[model samples]
Target: MTSTVVEQLIVPIRRSVTRVFNYSRNVKGLKTHLEELSDAKTRVLHSVDEARNRSEDIEDDVGKWLASVNVITEEATRVFGDEDKANKRCFMGLFPNVTTRYKVSTKIESIAEEAVKISVRGKFDRVSYRPSRRGIEDRSHKHYEAFESRGPVLDEILEALKDDDVDLVGVYGMPGVGKTTLVKKVAGQVKAGKIFDVVVLAVVSQTPNLRKIQGEIADGPGLKLDAETDSGRADFLYERLKREPKVLVILDDIWERLELDDVGIPSGSDHRGCKILMTSRDRNVLSRGMVTKKVFWLQVLPENEAWNLFKKMAGDVVKYPDLQLVAVEVAKRCAGLPILIVTVARALKDGDLSEWKDALERLKRFDKDEMDSQVYSALELSYDSLKGEEIRSAFLLCQQYRVVER
Candidate 1:
């Protein structure tokens, strides 16, 4: 009986001693596993960097996995720290500190298992995805009413755009002649036809903001400009534009000569894939100032189309026999300007026969010698038709800021 009891005690004591001996080895093994985890983290971080360069959004699971790796790494650092201190607690630095070593080794084993599991989970087929581009849905062809007159002009512009040799195309017309609307319509068509891989649009207006223009262009391609200066942003924008295989940059409402380089456009010989389409009131701004390769003059609608547009805006009252003659004369007074036609048509649409005659007389009375007198007179009539001073002031405010889209 005594021999059997001693044998059992010996067996238990030997197993305990063997486990104590493995504490240091277990800590070392933790180091190797943590290194594997670090390698995995590095690979994932590299992928994240690449995805960011492409302007792609990181995957949710991938992002979470990265966070988890960071936490595990920090925990491993603390474990290694504990292991160092635990080694110091040994007798004369030559024996293991059994209690602390056991505690640290057990914790290390648990954490190391977690790290391995997370590393394996980090193997993803894709780390990021292409986000939906904005401007297309919000701005393309909003409130565009196609007319027979606009069709040919749009076709001509599209044709010029498709030509590999034509890099700069210009569309010039008087104000309220639908330059903005025409270009927007072109934007819609170009996108649908795939004439260009992408279309970026920015309005230059009478006073141009180079920074705003650059920002608008960058927004189209999902490029984030971190540069603080205009020139720096220009450099970034120029590089970005160069990468597009085919891109159309629509610089609408350019009042004067705009420096393409300042706006970061890679026009002419700099980039063959890039094409610029601009609009302005004066043909000279486009021809002489911009040195456009091809210039298209957008004339006011022909008389027939003008009358059709007026009738559409003014409603069926324009077609009534009693009002038809006076309406035709009133439509003629608009001089075929689309903005004038729409304005006068709506103002008189709900009025009586007497009101129609009064509008016709007032439109006829504006000084013909003044530039855009006819347009001004039509706008005045529309202005007078408003019911309140507040609404009229708002109208003038829009006019002052040039925010009123033609």
Candidate 2:
């Protein structure tokens, strides 16, 4: 098993190492861009605009390019830094299927003030930016969407559990509407806070496999279940979970209603201190699985909120002065879908209007296809357009399951 883990990792690790090597030259280019931006004055005569354009080309392109690269590297590494199994599973397994959302704990004043510094807007109330807080700009605004975890959403969910009146809590939304993301966000904080004696987060795909799920639930409380039989595994799990004073189990992406007893995982209700949180696309599924608590429904992010979230991950790449109008039209087409926002934004990260227009056309024809592909496509150009294009192309084209990228 350990060897299998190493084998699984070699490919991505090698790919990462190769990326580091292949990008060394490009990294040097970043230094050159920095040198220019460092010296470029903010204010110039109107007549120098065209000449400035000619001179600032290196800095403009390199600044955005390196900034984008840093975005991916830093974001991917932090979210995906688990040492072994979690990292291995997380890179493709955990993160690809899910994006996280927590509450924004920052006050309105700070958010607005920070937006001014970044020169990005934080307000989404109007089609135009309010002039001096009382008027509007035809094409200016203070806010866009992001997939970042926030503090308020986190606190609300954690507190909801504390309310005894709430039972069989459910977070419902369409597939990839961040149902999984919400649960995972909560699970991380809850586990980190040591809020419970045991916390287990498991990905329950469409199959609803009891055997596999039993193994997963039992993974909590440090109990080793080398048991081969389903019943044996269940027995061990029940014993381990029975004594814990506080336990929280997150059953992620539950496709259908399942009897917890049959699966060998106990709902916290039995012990007065346990809680089971779930994510599902179907309300019926949540209702059926309402073992001990009520369900909470999550809607797709509102148009403004969704765009804000997507634009944040997308960073400066999507905010081109050149493609602003066309991109807004394209963003509208996403119909406030978080997955679509992410997928389309990622697909357009290269900042090519022509390519972006082509992708918009593609989305028109195949908008409802796998959200994963759309999201991955957003990063396709940047991650692919670099050198070693053939290697990148080959590795990406391979099937997701059991892919050995090395």
**Off by more than 4 A, model 2:** 1-156, 165-167, 192-194, 289-292, 366-406
User: Using lDDT as the measure, which candidate wins?
Assistant: 1
TM-score of candidate 1 relative to the true fold: 0.67
Candidate 2 lDDT by residue in tens digits, 1-406: 9999998989876755444343324334434443343233222222235444433223243334335444434533442232132223345465521112111111212233332332222111222111221111111212322244334454667887767665356677655456665666666556556676667766687777777787667554435577788777777776677688777777877767777766666664565676777777667777765653566667656667766766765568666787776676567565555655665565556657786676555435434465544333332333344334442453254222112111
Q: Which residue pairs overlap in candidate 1's backbone? A: none
Q: Candidate 1's residue-wise lDDT over 1-406, tens digit each?
A: 9999999999977755655677778777778887888888898899999999887999999989989988988988888888675675666877778777667767777887898899889899999988967545246556677778788888899999989989999999877788878887787778877888878889898889998999888888778899999999999999989999999999999989999999899988899999999999889999999999889989988999999899999999987898999999899888778876876677678878888888778777768887666555554554666534543553464253233223
- Estimate candidate 2's RMSD in Å: 31.7
Q: Each model's C-alpha lDDT?
A: 0.82, 0.53
lDDT of 1 at 82: 85
